[model samples]
Target: MLTKFSITRSCALRKFTFLFLLLSGQILKAQSPAADGKSSFTAKLINIEAATTEVFRYNTTLHNGDAKSKVVELKADLPIGWMISFKADGSQVTSVAMDAGKTQDISIEINASATADPSKYKIPVKAVSGSDTLALNLEAVVKGSYGLTLTTPTGRLSEELTAGSHLDIQLVVKNTGTLPLKDIDLSSQLPSNWEASFEPSKISSLEPGKSQELKARLKVPDKTIAGDYAATFTANNPNGNAPAVFRIIVKTSLLSGWIGILVILLSVGLVYYLIRKYGRR
Candidate 1:
């Protein structure tokens, strides 16, 4: 009777322990997030700041918590004129395959319009697998871009001028970027003894996509050699600089040409007179 009771007690203890373990496992499963049969989309950084001309990159992950594998399709809602793409394993992809309780690493590339204004934009990205959809919100802060372009109104870079005279050139200064340009100073690199001046030597401010007209007075010194010379005109600011090279062709004045003709005629007349007088003697 004692041996039988001991054996029965041992079996009862084992049964109670097994029941307790089974109950504990059920409770733990209920508490686990993955056990809920839900998916997740997460990113270490959801907000980024960059210039309008630069590309925005975000590193993210997609997690599958379901009991089966899934083909997750990725998508993003972006503003018009903006572009977005996804990459997995260094290759461009729109969907990824994930096994149960597995995770996938992805990269999101976004490009805002080059002319986009400086502002904060919201981008909503989603991962969908059948009836399950996981969403993530991303923010992009676009900064201003500074750029300048200096050229003539007619797009001609060459000019002709007479020596010892001044020429008035119309210069068009354009703000080629998305931001305003301020305190832009005008300057030039010319040959020695040459003079250059702008009507408005300094620009207070120029708006994006807008142009300002300025008069550039270029003076060539008297007696300058007749040849093609290079003149570089620059519009400079703290942010950027635009330099334009112009070809200048110098020619003697019409009065000087007439004087040369007279001199040549006089020399010919004198030589003819000398030859006749000396030959007769």
Candidate 2:
């Protein structure tokens, strides 16, 4: 039979061997990267604050922590009708090749359609290299797109005009947009040597769904031919601009019109008198 001291010694030896192997395995795992020259990677995403229907920019920074250079591909899943692109050094790119432990700054341009409504949108960003993938989330705040519309109070797009006289026109300027409009400048397109002015050259402020009246005085040239002509009135604001057209019908002056009527009557009376005097002769 085995003695008690021998038995204890055997058990101690077995425990020592097990502990030594465990420590050896830990050391190997810690040094495996340096020994095998394997590469590691890291990716990061940045957030976007806000954007408009107009072209806006966001930025992202990526770092490569591996010992080897890699071509990292980037992509984004955005809302419908939305677009995203990446740029580095002012040139567009779909992916970036970076050296180990190096960082790159990329320009992320995001744009929405003009018809896009005001809301918050979440964008999913991805970076991939081989089997490694990094997922990130971003938010885009879309502000309202403002617009201005200039028209007649009755919504008539045409108006009457005369030469050598001042014609008064009334217009309705409305803020037909999602945001308030301010400092709207009024202007007009007219024939040469003609003059046009508005009562309020610039509006102070116009809220959405609000309308204001503007009186325009147009001075037609004396020599303007009597025919159809087109004139445009525009209201321009920082948000957008609206244009209105008017059809000018240059009518004959009162004096000329009366004279024409008198001539026609005289000619008819003369004809009647000649017929009566020579009918029997």
Candidate 3:
């Protein structure tokens, strides 16, 4: 009942089966590497960055890594640990377009946080722009544990800085937080009806334990109203836009004051005569 031929054939078959499995594994090993072994995941959202004025905006776009027609849903995914800030002032609607049935690129938004640098306060965007629908949770947060404290610029302005006068308004941006401040953006609002220009247009950067110099040119009109005026300002790093308001007080020259007086007199006389005649008593 035991034939040597049959037994030999079975053994041969078993050997071949073992060889096949071994070779197949080698082929798979040569083909691709496991993602977890060396690849890194996409960046995740931690905080919502924002601009002080709603008129300004921050945005970015992403593409679906898949090559075929795939359904993609976009959402914001916030990191577990961070101080998040949410304000309704930054709600500006937007739209994104993609190639039909092809690449998947979705736009992501970084919102403004309550405490962020005024100049570089930008939120990094991360979302699943892939074949699967994604629900992302995003929010705003300050930069460091001991975040930068933005001081609102405060000071007294000069009265009627003469026309073509060098306009140097001193402002103090202090480090109110445990951490330091750097790369600050200092901007001043011109008088309501006044035209002025800054030497640098903008102060590029500043660090904690330091104060920066900024100056502008105030060109008064020949008929400029010489009196007290004020302008709002901001000493900002991207963290947040703190308000710096200053008083600009000025007085017209004697010749200019005389011209103003003459106009006032003529106007007062005209008004008085008109009122006297119109006395419908």
Candidate 4:
């Protein structure tokens, strides 16, 4: 039979050995790095129909024992028909295009008319084979608010008007580019002694291929001069102020009194004298 002290000692030794083994196993596990620790998205633009493409990608990663591993995911954002053109000198801006997700990188071709063909184009090699591999088509559909605009309206003024009269100024604001212009401020530097008033001094918006009518009333002072009046109408740009010019002339009624009658009579008498003398000669 084992003594009580001997039995106690044997149980203590077993417990110590088990604890040491468990600790050693944990240390070894800690040293190993997880194989699947990160997940991210990578995108590349491939030209298919347009100039440039904006691409978005997503990646998912999971780390666990064979049966318990889970996947983390990320999404890709790829726009269609987006393109960028570089300047030859590398200083000046050539061209840039954005797109929605329906398109990849687009091939550009100069048509007989010099317009880019969106339907028949291909992507460049560098864009497709790149590591990102995400294609985005950012063909700008529309940007900013629009109604009707005129790029030619800057620095434009109507002809001079008589004093206290309204001038029908036909200002054309065109959508020179393929964008919309909104809520533009219209202001003017009226000619000296002239008051320029416009209806709807502030526009609501301007879309492509549309126009607005600005009824302007011009008032010239009685003391105004007959020379050209320089009036500058300005539309302040987000970048700078665009300007237009108008001329105004102050005019007066002609005199039809004794002076006018005398002038007519002198002309008639001179003509009669010339006819008589020539006929006799």
RMSD of every candidate to native, in Å, equals 7.1, 14.9, 15.4, 15.7
Write candidate 2's Cα lDDT for 171-281 as tens digits. 999876657899999999987788999998899999866899989998988778788888899999877899998887887777767988999999999999999999779
Off by over 4 Å in 2: 1-51, 151-176, 180-224, 227-230, 236-241, 245-281
Cα shift from native, residue 250, model 1 (Å): 2.5
Give candidate 1 misplaced runs (Cα > 4 Å): 1-36, 67-70, 262-281
- Name the top TM-score candidate: 1
Per-residue accuracy of model 3 over 1-281 as CA lDDT, tens digit each: 97999999999999999999999999986673323221111324434443322222223333433333333333333433222222223443232333322232233434333333444333333333343433333344344322333232454444347543445554455544424555666566766556655545554544534554456555555455656667666666765556655566665667766887999999999999989999766
In every candidate, how many clashes are there?
A: 0, 0, 34, 54
Worst 10 residues of 1 by lDDT: 29-38
Model 3: CA > 4 A from native = 1-158, 162-166, 180-182, 258-281
122 Cα displacement, candidate 1 (Å): 0.4
* Candidate numbers sorted by lDDT from highest down: 1, 2, 3, 4
After TM-score superposition, what is the CA distance of residue 145 in candidate 1 from its true location, in Å? 2.4
- What is candidate 3's TM-score against the reference? 0.35
Shift of residue 28 alpha carbon in model 4, Å: 47
C-alpha positional error of residue 103 in candidate 3 after TM-score superposition, expressed in Å: 58
Q: Which candidate tops lDDT?
A: 1
* TM-score of each candidate structure, all chains considered together: 0.76, 0.53, 0.35, 0.39
What 10-residue stretch in candidate 4 is worst by lDDT? 96-105
Q: Looking at model 2, which ten-residue stretch has the lowest summed lDDT?
A: 34-43
